[model samples]
Target: YRELLLRQRINEAAQAVMVAYAMGGDLDQLAANYNVKRLTVTPADNDAVPPVAAVMESDEALRLRVPAAFEGLSVAGPTAAYEFH
Candidate 1:
């Protein structure tokens, strides 16, 4: 718990530094101008977008042990309660 809190504080501090740098504040000059240590970041080699939709579970992949007639019915209201002739 103690270590997690310390890591969270460090992360928040880094985020603040990033926000300041984004608002036209010089990162390298922060130490000399404001007497603060500038946060350094190295860009990753592969900055590709992740294929999230490809690995998501589809409707067909849902596992239910119910009958076929009760498959897509919603039991929340009286509209689905009527039986078909």
Candidate 2:
């Protein structure tokens, strides 16, 4: 049991470091490297059923956005800049 618990914790820690699997603060930190910040959702005041009170970008979405940000740095072309990375 102890060994299994240790392995689980290790797996969690490992995933936290990877953008493909990281969540919350870990994902936030990774996004920061690209100068990207997660967007927040604003609930409608008059709607009968508003969206979640605190909706933040999902890890999957943020992961996609981080790479796209690299495209913006290009003076020549996105493809060229992207290929440099």
Candidate 3:
């Protein structure tokens, strides 16, 4: 069924996210494991957004904004491949 297939893909995506997260701060490993381009993001040097919100709410991370089903391993915009403080 279409619904079942969709659920399967969602599961895969979630698993991918978990896998990438488990890689710790290693972007190379994340990209190599997921077979996708990897890049890191930080709010602009002068931007006003809180760094925590930037990672927790930005398009890069789906952990907050979208339903668990709709969020894939990656989204349309930047993804936070690493965190620096």
Q: How high is each candidate's TM-score?
A: 0.24, 0.67, 0.25
- Please report the candidate that would top TM-score against the real structure: 2
Give the total clashing residue pairs for model 2.
0
Candidate 2 overall Cα lDDT vs. reference?
A: 0.79
Candidate 2, after superposition: displacement of residue 11 in Å? 0.7
Residue range 1-85, candidate 3, lDDT tens digits: 9999999888766665553333334433444443443334543344445524222222344222223223344455333321110
Cα lDDT for residue 81, model 1? 33
Per-residue lDDT tens digits for candidate 1, residues 24-48, read: 2333333333333322233334445
Which 10-residue window in model 3 sums to the lowest lDDT? 62-71
Candidates 2 and 3: which is better by lDDT?
A: 2
Worst 10 residues of 1 by lDDT: 58-67
Q: Provide the lDDT at 58 for model 1.
A: 22
lDDT of 2 by residue, 1-85 (tens): 9999999999999998888888889999988988888876554355447543666767787887777777767888767466534
Local distance difference test, each candidate: 0.37, 0.79, 0.41
Lowest lDDT block of 10, candidate 2: 43-52
- Per-candidate count of clashing residue pairs (backbone under 3 Å): 0, 0, 0
